[model samples]
Target: MAFYLVTGGAGFIGSHIVEKLVRRKEKVRILDNFSTGKRENIAPFLEKIELIEGDIRDSGTVTKAVKGVDYILHQAALPSVPRSIKDPVTTNEVNVLGTLNILMAAKELGVKKVVYASSSSVYGETPQLPKMEDMQPSPLSPYALSKL
Candidate 1:
């Protein structure tokens, strides 16, 4: 069975991904700070998986969690735009730096693949028709910049 390390697995989107993974019979581990993610989101599968309550900013914690995992679904980030604007430092720490930490851990652990969830706000307010991956990026908020 492939092991999946899901960061931010207690948050809105992460929990759903984790639930689906659990149902597929995959060995799953969750890494969450619980800053905005709720315990209730992950309560349904508490007994079927491994839980690591820690922030992604802490290298030791993230590294330990990523160890032996074959795949990574990095979902840990400060999601709210207003929240990021209110606290850019924390937002950058959790979003950008935390992502770097996970990437490094994945490299060290020789993980097969690392998947990231990036938003489509990079194009800003331009009246562009189709949003393509190669388009120029325009970040309006710290949240958008972090996701970039």
Candidate 2:
């Protein structure tokens, strides 16, 4: 049986992804700190998922959670620009360092592709209408720079 691990699977978009994976008849697990994610989001499909309530910045916790997972979806992040601006330390701890923890765990466990979520605020104050992937960034906020 193939196993899938979704970090921050209790959040809005992460919950949707976890629901789809569960519907597809795949073995799935979740890692969430519950800092921003709401419990109600995943309450409907609790049976199918093994929820691990822990911070992603903790490598030991993350590493332990990565076992027996064939695929990984890293959706955990400090997504709000305003929050990132006001409290960048926690934002970086969760968004950047936590993402790094996921990457390290994935690499060590030999898991397949890991899709990590990123904020669009990296687009900065550029007047460019349609933002492409490769744009010279001009970040106006700390959150924007962090994402960049």
Candidate 3:
């Protein structure tokens, strides 16, 4: 089985990813601060995965989590536009700086791939219904801009 590290694996989307990975019998490790993630989300499969309760912004924690991992699925972030507006500093610290930490760890550890979960809001408001990836991003909020 392949070993995987899933940051924010206790959150909504991240929890689902953990579920799928566990079902496949992959060895999975979770690193979540639980700022936004709930304990109940991961309660069902606690024994199946390794849990590391920590923040992504901490380089030491991130570096430790990335060790011996085949892939890094970076899903940790402080989400929501309104929340970002209310506290841009916290949002930037978690989203931007946290992501930087993940990238740095993955690069230093020689991990082959890092799958980052970027918000679709990066596409911004446009007349185009099906927001194409090629389109230039025009972020409307601090959260959207950080995702870009």
Candidate 4:
């Protein structure tokens, strides 16, 4: 079975991903700090996967989490515009630096793929009704900028 690592696997989206992977009988591993993620989200399949409680900002923890993993589904982030405006440093550290850490670890470990979950807020205040990837990103808040 292909091993999969889902960062922030205890969060809403991440938990759903984990459930799908588990239902497919894939070998799944979860890395979550639980700062914003809730335990109940993954409670249904808690026994089916390996859970690592740690922050992505810590390289050591990230390395440990990525070791021996084949694919990485990166979903960890501090989401909020007002909160990021209040504390941009923490947002950058978690969203940007934490992502860097995951990439570095994935590279060193020879992981096959890394799927990043970015926010639509990166589009900022585009006048267009529908946001397309072709459009240039106009991040307004620190949270959006960090995701970009």
Candidate 5:
């Protein structure tokens, strides 16, 4: 069984990912600070997976989470646009620096893969339908910039 680490595994999207992994009987581990994540989201399978309650901004915590993991599903972030505008510093620290911590830890520990969840807001408000990856990213908000 491949060891999978889902960061922010208590959040909406993260919880769903955890549920899928659990259904597949994979060895799952969760790293979540629970700042915006709810306990009830992951309550069903709490005992089935290893849980580490910590912030991703801390390198030590990130390293601990990534160690011995095969694939990293990075979903942790301050995902609010208005909140990022209000507090860009914390947003950058959590979204940018926190992601950097995950990347560095994954590389150092020889993890096979690191799957990142990026926001579509990076494209900004374009009238064009069906956003393509090649389009120029015009991030308007601090949150979008951080995701980019």
Candidate 6:
């Protein structure tokens, strides 16, 4: 079985990923500070998966979390355009710097892959139904900029 480390695994999207992984009987680990993620989301699977309650910004915590994990599904971030606009510093710290920490840890630990969960808002408001990967990012808010 593949070992997967999902940051923010208690959040909406992350929780779903955790559920699918558990269903498939994969070894899963989660690191979340619960700033935005709710306990109820992950409560059901607490005994099934290993969970580390910590922030991604903390290097020691991230370092400890990354150990022995093969793939990292980087889903942790301060996710809100309006919230980012309100607190750009926090947003950048959590979304950008926090992600950098994860990437650095993953790289140093020799992780096989790191799949980042990027926002479609990076493409801005266009008539396009499906935004292509080649499309240029036109971020309107700090949140969008961080995602870019």
Cα lDDT listed for each candidate: 0.93, 0.86, 0.93, 0.96, 0.97, 0.94
Instruction: Show where candidate 4 strays beyond 4 Å.
Output: none
lDDT string for model 2 (24-133, tens) is 98898999989889999999999878999999999999998898799898888877888877898988888788888888989999998888676667777777778887
Model 2 pairs whose backbones collide: none
lDDT of 1 by residue, 89-147 (tens): 99899899999999999999899999998877767777877888898999899999999
Q: lDDT for model 6, on a 0 to 1 scale?
A: 0.94
- CA lDDT of 25 in candidate 5? 98
What lDDT is reached at residue 80 by model 1? Answer: 86
Say which prediction, candidate 2 or candidate 3, comes out ahead on lDDT. 3
The TM-score measured for candidate 3 stands at 0.96
Report the C-alpha lDDT of model 3 over 1-148, residue by residue, as the tens digit: 8899999999999999999999999999999999999989999999999999999999999999999999988889998999999999999999999999999999999988999898879877778878877888989889998998
Worst 10 residues of 3 by lDDT: 124-133
Stretches of candidate 2 off by over 4 Å are 127-130
Clashes, model 2? 0
**lDDT by residue (tens digit), candidate 4, 1-148:** 9999999999999999999999999999999999989999999999999999999999999999999999999999998899999999999999999999999999999999999998889998878977887778889999999998
Model 4's C-alpha root-mean-square deviation from the true structure amounts to 0.9
Q: Cα RMSD to native, each candidate?
A: 1.4, 1.6, 1.0, 0.9, 0.8, 0.8
On the 0 to 100 scale, the lDDT of residue 116 in model 5 is 95
- Candidate 4: which pairs clash? none
Q: Could you tell me every candidate's TM-score relative to the true structure?
A: 0.93, 0.91, 0.96, 0.97, 0.97, 0.97
